[model samples]
Target: MTPQRRVTLADIAAACGLSKATVSMVLRDNPQVHPNTRARVRAELDRQGYVYHRGAASLRRAGAVNAVALVVNDLANPFFAEFAAGVDAALAEAGHVLLLGSTGESVERQHAVLASLVEHDPAALILSPAEHSSAARLRRVLGARLPVLLFNRRLDGDGPGDWDYLALDNRAGARLATEHLLARGHRAIAFFGGHRDSSSCSERREGYRDALAAAGITPDPAWLIECAPTRQEAARQTPALFVRDPAPTAAVCYNDAVALGLMAGLAACGRRAGADFAVVGFDDIAESAFATPALTTIATEPRARGLQAARLVLARLRGELPASPHTTIAPVALQVRASTAAAPDSPLQSSVQARGPAA
Candidate 1:
């Protein structure tokens, strides 16, 4: 027996007693088509099991697909997960679909994913680039035609070539976290989690250093602990804080995941957070509020940042934004909670008390 023929626009037109152009208009949601005519066309198309060929349509239209691509370093991390959800929500509102990819922080994987996404002919791409990604390498993989937005991470170069950037105020956020600890009398504070080479991590570390310097306190080199920005890795590395003489009385962690893990690690080491040891984290993820002795963190508001990134891409696609590439540095706020407090009998607190009631 011969295979059945595929359904086409003409078939639906014939069944609906409407012209093929009318049926086509209905399929494209053209406002000129009458509502009743649209209903008939849609019913017949569904009954015939017709599927719209988006890829083929994009090719026919010279590479205009009704979807945007989002690539992030790690989707499993709550920060990225929330950011992706925000992007998805905004895209859905704009009647566009999202094609997502996770690189697991591998540049090779990012190249592979970008290559695949480009074949789909997305309208634009929003990327949180993997560690060590360079503009030259990404440009080679993405080519010049596609408009791109860089989120959170910056490429290792003078500037990100012709791509719009949305950067979290990493240095400011870290400074805020560190300052909060200092205000609470934590003199020996460690900076924990994330590799030193990462742009975001480095900026945060600089901020940490700035706050310490302002207070005339210099952190020991060993206090700057490096670990993958994940809970498990942070937990595994937490014990290192106590290895040296004059260990940190408090810590400013990379992100919420690391902070939460450190809290667990503290428990395992018979030290309790917010009491015996103070901890402050960056990125106020959802779990931060619910963690035992809620986390004190710098809130980047990942979901809102995601929405802003999506809006930026959408605006660029519509030609609403200027052709000149620009960078938007999102501001962060410190969310104080139980996780951070005055160091137990700290000399800093004693000195402050000695100064006594601001004269």
Candidate 2:
């Protein structure tokens, strides 16, 4: 028979002629163990090639996001994919890994995901909340213990005291889109998609109204559609708006996804996006630039937001800074594309010849 393995914790204990418990205590760096005993155990451990497990060290060091749980509203959206990639890169640099979960825009789903994440005992959590998440529900799952950072979206009517938030300047981005439409001589413009209670949607709506009011135009409430944040829902809603009497000459969409869906819907109605109707979208997603006619959009840096979130988590974990309860990232700028050009000065005119193609 092959010789038994020579070096185990038992072997070390035998060589030192000490009890297994004494050896364990020494190896574990228990202060109760005498210094001489610890020195002897260290010498034996070195001689025997003994290695201690790191699991205890990890648990001791965990603050929030030592192992991070990244919760998002939708995984299908490319915006979330790119943002998660950025979060991964940042987390890797900090020696932490991200665990991602999607809520599918359901409050019950959000609750389930949140509950599952809590059970895993992550060091920290980052959430891009769904529309109907409640503070009471979140607190019940976490029990006021683990640190959580809300990203991209906020809890409705939430005060600053309960949580930390990192998000984009959605209102300003909306203002940019609306202002761009206004600059291009669009008077009858409409806001599209997104639910009522979402802070992001509400801010965007506020900005839309602000721009309209600034330009001496009253918003037509009938044109504002609080549709679901999905392509199919946006597609379903678009034709109804287009078919209405006194249809809007231009529409400002919630995001690139909504804009793309609206275009699809317009196609079904035998309407061309840029040629027949002007549309402006937000988020400046990669596909938005390559879409047919291209998309005129307000740009916010999602990757930058992800990186900032990672830094926030790591900083809190390392105790390098106090937990910031509120953080807001501003929008970058508007990118004008082929979409959302003026239809014509007069409604009866078929087309207005451009002086030159948009650069």
Best by TM-score: 1
Error of 2 at 176 (Å): 0.7
Provide the lDDT at 307 for model 2.
84
Best by lDDT: 1
TM-score of 1: 0.90
lDDT of 1 by residue, 139-233 (tens): 99999999999998788883546799999999999998898888777789999999888889999999999999999998899899999998998
Residue 35 of model 2, lDDT score:
92
Off by over 4 Å in 1: 1-5, 16-19, 29-43, 46-49, 62-64, 158-160, 347-359
Measured over all alpha carbons after superposition, the RMSD of each candidate to the real structure, in angstroms, is: 3.9, 5.7
Error of 1 at 332 (Å): 0.6
lDDT by residue (1-359, candidate 2, tens digit) is 96756466677889999887888788657899889989998998998787654344456554333578898877778888777877888998988878889998888998888888777777788888888788777788777877777887778557664677787788888888888777666788889998867888988899899999999999877879878877788888897676567889889998888898998888889888877888888888889989887888888767777888878877766666665565756556788887776655644234332222332
Q: At residue 77, what lDDT does model 2 achieve?
A: 87
Provide TM-scores for the models: 0.90, 0.82
Can you give the lDDT of residue 48 in candidate 2? 78
CA error at residue 53 for candidate 2, angstroms: 5.4
